[model samples]
Target: MKLKKIGNVEANYSFWQVLVVCSGQEFLDSGEDLIASFEINSPDVRLVLCLTDDLLAARELLKSLAQKLIALSMYELELDGDVDDNQRALPYQIARNVLLQTRLPTLLLESCSFVRRDITLLPAELQKADCALKLRFNRKGISQKVLTNTLWLLPNSRVDRFLAQAISGMAKTTSENEERKAVYKALQACRGFLKVAALPGRYADRSHKHEGFIWVRLPKEKAETTAAREFREKTRARFARPPEVIILHPKQDLGTKSHLENNTFKRRVERLARPGRIAWRQMARLLVELSWERGKPARLVPLPQWKITKEALKNYEFAKTIFVPHLISAQLPHPKAYYYMQELVPMLFTVDRNGWGGVDSI
Candidate 1:
């Protein structure tokens, strides 16, 4: 919150810099919710909120949360007199201007969307490629479309310049649909210059329900289309793997009325909750073990005679209600399950070298 120096810059090759475009009260509310929901202080992650409106209340709100954010920063963008009435171009304009000053890898996000803790997964993926994008299958199923609002770009002069130019082109377009098409085209053209990686699942935004499930959800006609077949083959050839397909258990059919019936729903919940409880207990036990190793004073030693501090007990109880539910939901054949297993689970079990446990305990 105090802009404390996190770690030696030379030790890390890159830091995670997040950019949020804020204009209205709704955006501010979602941005605030994002801050409160997850532990965003990863030492290498910084959040930048770009304010484009002259809202005094918005400034006050962000100021109040300054102490709550460890690496939060703000930028005020001045609108030109020729700005259009629709204000559709404002987000891209702000992003282009900010790109000029961004030295580290940057993630562009919409203020209305909330990213879960799996946001950390992008940095590692970005490190291996020049850019990472959240691609979703279009309704036509001929090709995949990029979610422009949530994009990741590594700090390369060419990549940044190319993306900025494409965004600039999009800003000048009057048609909303054409703007998206223009950006998608731009990404395709620049693929030769950039090694692009796909951000799997709903890591970018919860609104992307079909992020990683497109392969499994495709209709037979769409799947058999020549374009769709070529797209699949090209993706596998380029990335050395097919698009991830989330397989729901037969009993846990998603978005189906039959599966949501009384008895079926109860059975499905019970099946997922069993593993959720086991994962929760294992997490709690690790916290207790770390607390003992740290030599913390125990308020009470429960059965098994393991010394558990009040802080650890409170953390465990809090996780039981919050994290356990998330864990269960993550395991319920959702598109984000693999992301949870890859990033969230290990993050929860990790014990920091500073003697403080990871987010699960601290």
Candidate 2:
């Protein structure tokens, strides 16, 4: 069967959107991390959640999340029978299918991995290129493999043709391992039409290993001075009026230090703080006091109590009504991991809120 086109290549989309495919309970556990990473790095970009599995719990999780993120959109993927059976390749197939329908410059984030740096800069990097992927190395360090699926960023100009060819290449493969090899071969086949660029030091894999990159921290005085200036600039751009209460929680740790060196902790803190500063910039108009409490827990200040917004409730209802029935009809087998999601839902609601507070502690 021929692929159906959903978007006009010539159509103009003013903004970029990121599509994240979530399937089972792993998403339920790490979904908030993905959202936080984006909020910290690319808050302006619209987030589209593509739920590939017919799991009611997965849809429910997104519905609750959408209320807090007004810019979020949710969609169900109608997977082809053969494609649906390949669990390893389902995400790629879903991405290839979604690329067919949208003209917006889109970045496909691997559902299991979260980015640590500013991903918004990738689209501009791809303006002159066809697609961009982060580079990874084997243990020997002599060979480099393109992380094509990990953080795939594609421009609208020729993305459809590229993905279509890549998917076609995968279709010819019989094994999961061969399917991946086919994608790499497909990149070579489309070299003339596609220019794959490398995004280094910008992403981390599932193991949370920082591939041979060394992080150099700026001098403390210079770093704070720069952060304050950038904070002021971003605040003015995002909000017409300044926010009344601006809380800076720099001490919060994301618990991603298992593979990081002790010295790299400070650099990681500094890197994480950039997103916090960007995220909370709108909450403060002027920089009144700048203080650094290195290695100290931020003293909690009483803020307004968070309540579930009407939009969130509405989205929950929409998920239960619209997505549930469709998912049921698809009859996708519910994985055992999905059962654990129910236990996490309440914790998800309590921990995830729109307010400026810490979800993790150092």
* Model 2: per-residue Cα lDDT over 149-258, one tens digit each: 44454545466666666666665456544655656666677778677776554443333333311111222354324543354344223222222222221112222223
RMSD in order of candidates:
18.1, 18.8
Instruction: Please give the CA lDDT of all the candidate structures.
Output: 0.43, 0.41
The model with the greatest lDDT is: 1
So what's the TM-score on candidate 1? 0.50
Residue 225, candidate 1: how far off, in angstroms?
33
Supply the TM-score for candidate 2.
Answer: 0.50
Candidate 1, position 306, lDDT: 18
How high is the lDDT of residue 67 in model 2? 42
Tens-digit lDDT track for model 1 on 277-350?
A: 34533444344334335543111111111111233223233121111112233223222221112135533533
Among residues 3 or more apart in sequence or in different chains, the pairs in candidate 1 whose N, CA or C atoms overlap within 3 Å are 1-70
Candidate 1, superposed: residue stretches over 4 Å from native: 1-14, 38-44, 70-86, 137-144, 174-176, 205-362
The residue ranges of model 2 lying beyond 4 angstroms of the native Cα positions read 1-14, 70-84, 136-144, 153-157, 172-177, 204-362
